[model samples]
Target: MTQRSITVLPGDGIGPSIVAAAIKILDAAGCQFQYDYADAGLSALEKYGELLPQTTLDLIAKNKVALKGPLTTPIGGGFTSINVTLRKHFNLYANLRPVVSFAGTQSRFENIDIITIRENTEGMYSGAGQTRALDNSSAEAMSIITHEGAERISEFAYQLAVKEGRKKVTIVHKANILKSTSGLFLEVAREVALRYPQIETNEMIVDAVCMNLVMYPERFDIIVTTNLFGDIISDLCAGLIGGLGMAPGANIGKEVAIFEAVHGSAPDIAGQNIANPCSVILAAIQLLEHLNMQDQAELIRAAIKKTLAQGKTITQDLSGSASTTEFTDAIIANL
Candidate 1:
């Protein structure tokens, strides 16, 4: 395979260490890629006086593929969310978060596998039309969902289901109440569902879906929903398997794709060396799959499974006492 260039964002907190572990495992898996490092989040703010510098954006555009660690976005004030900004900037329409059960974890469920396909750039979660009242008593935000956005995301979901041989695609929404926005989404998604007769389609209200997810998770295969719901549901699915430390997300657009650990920057454990690196490692697997390096992706995945199944040299999050580097070393050794 020809060497590919990938932009690497080390992010903040434990992001740097986990990202380093992921890169080492990738190399061990025999992936031929050149990495171009850039800074974002708090690290960039401290060094460049901005959360996201133009130079970083330029590098991401040039590479068209990025492996990002969890970035810290300051709450309140004038700072916009770096993750949201990147998604909208790149028009990354699909947020693919997949969680699967790994042996030797402390999770209750076993043989769990689910993927949440989130509409990345629209709806209530986009922070569009946000405003505050003069009296400081009330505030409001607008949720705008276009027919094009809904249709495309629905199409993307079914296409992925077909490709992966997934049995069903659940169209999750709350069309009963938020009729205007959610109703439009349901309408368009149902239209898309009719086009894919080979794949089973199930529609459930957002609230009910949440309850069913916890009670009967196996009934779900691929969950497709709007921005806010997807963000919440993906994390819930992660909990079923283990936790956010085991989840991986991929934001994909026509020209560019960014894979990342779908968890927050753990500033509390920034340099403890005990933070779990599986999230970023799984994210690298997604990146490899995106680049069509399936053999290498599966190789790394199998190694991770073996390491976790052995119930040894795993991180604290997975109920083991190994540090991030030790956990990484175990995976590399398995590879």
Candidate 2:
């Protein structure tokens, strides 16, 4: 068997601690891989003077897969976003985030198995915006959207639904108000819907979609939308299950994929060792599944599910009594 190569970018703060735990779990599971350490975010700027170095991009291009820890986008903005850059650079247009309710975790709803398929590239995130301040009282940011971007993402969503055995896909947009931009998004989605006859398709305005999500989350199986809407709704979906701490995400393209924790870097709790590693650990499971190590992925997921169902050693947010490493060890023991 050829060893799978992966670029590991453990950015500043709790990213290192959490990723360390995930690596330990992978090692114990005997996952064969070579990890190349790379730089991004604040740590990268401090060391290499660039948040996302060309070398880092080069490494990911070479490896074609990366397992990244949470990266803190700088406040004042040197780069737009390291995450966004990686996605666009590789044309990673599909951002998949699965929000499932764990057995033991505290959740508002039960049996919530929703997957948010976000259009990762293009839309307003493509740096297609103009900012102008007319005497500070009024400022405008013009967002642009294209049919090509919308159609590809919608098609990707439908194909994913078919592949994953999902029944329906809901296209969420804001076409009612943002007529031109979001209208085009909906038009493209409807165009794509024609091709996927077997899968049921629906469209919901972004606002209504949020309300429906809270009122009846089970109605949604796969939610696909533009970049900005997807960013908001994905987190909202996370809340229905628990919170961002428990969410895991993947940025995928034809050639490469990057698995990462969906939450941001918690600088305050950086070295406290109290941060949750489940998100990153689960992301590693996603990496395994992406590599076609289905058996290994199932083993890890089963161990996690079993551990959670037992309700013994969970993190603070999950309302249990265990440190980060302790929780990780519990999962490893169960495995």
Candidate 3:
């Protein structure tokens, strides 16, 4: 078998620590992969004076697969988002985030499993047009949602649900008010849902869905929504289980896919060596599953679950004394 090559962006702060741990686990599993490092986000801005360097983009284009750690998006910034740039450049239109409550965790909700399929390439996150009002006290920002974008992401969601053996897929929208943009999304979703009769589907407004999620999260199976709603729901589902510390995400398209941890770079705990790496490790497992290495993916997942189940070698967030490396070592040893 030919070893797959992947671009690795251990972005910033705790990003490097987590990626290092994931690499350790990957090596221990004997997974055959060649890695090339790239730079983006704050790290790239500091080293290369460019947030999303062309060199990094070139590498990803050639490799077509990447494993990225959490990247810090500067607030009120001149820099474009590293994630947004990559997604737009590669046409990675589907942002898939799966959230599940693992056993032995102290979560308020149980048996909670939801997959959020987000439109990765467009929406307000696209950095659309903005202008100042005549008063200069008010500003306006545009949010564009096209039928082409809506159709592709919705179809991708339904198809993924079918392949994964999921029976119901929920489409979320805000068409009641943003009747033009979100209405187009709702129209596309309704059009796409007709093809898969075996899989039941429903549409819900974003606000009502949020309320329902908190009240009865188990009712949801697979959720398909626009860029912004999907982003919010995915994070909420993560919090139901634990937090972003354990959430993993993937950006997939026709040609390329990038698996990433769905958390931010915690600069405060950067060198403290206490950040959890399971999210990134699980993201690698996602990458493996994407590559059709299901057996290896299961092995890595089992090792992680077993390590967490041990309950002795957990990071501070999980309420144990183990440092980042120690926790990773535990998982590697178990594997």
Which residue pairs show collisions in model 2?
none
| Candidate 1 similarity to native, TM-score | 0.98
Task: Kindly report which residue stretches of model 1 are placed more than 4 angstroms away from their true locations once superposed.
Answer: none
**Which residue window of length 10 is worst by lDDT in model 2?**
127-136
Worst 10 residues of 1 by lDDT: 125-134
How far does residue 179 in candidate 1 sit from its true spot (Å)?
0.3
Compose the digit string of candidate 1's lDDT tens values, residues 1-335. Answer: 66899999999999999999999999888897899999999999999999999999999999999999989988887677899899999999999999999988889988899999999999986765354444768677779899999999999999999999999999999999999999999999999999999999999999999899999999999999999999999989999988988999999999989999989899988999999999999999999999889999999999999999998898888889999999999999999
| TM-score, one value per model | 0.98, 0.96, 0.96
Clashing pairs in 3: none
C-alpha lDDT (0 to 100) for residue 60 of candidate 1: 97
Task: Tell me, by lDDT, which candidate is best.
Answer: 1
- Per-residue error at 255 for model 3, in Å? 1.2
Q: List ranges where model 3 is wrong by over 4 Å.
A: 128-135
Reference-based TM-score, model 2: 0.96
Candidate 2 local lDDT, 148-261, one digit each (tens) = 888888988899899999999998988888899889989999999999999999899999999999999989999989888898999998898778778999999999999998
Candidate 2: lDDT over CA atoms?
A: 0.87
Query: What TM-score number comes out for model 3?
Result: 0.96
| Per-candidate local distance difference test | 0.93, 0.87, 0.87
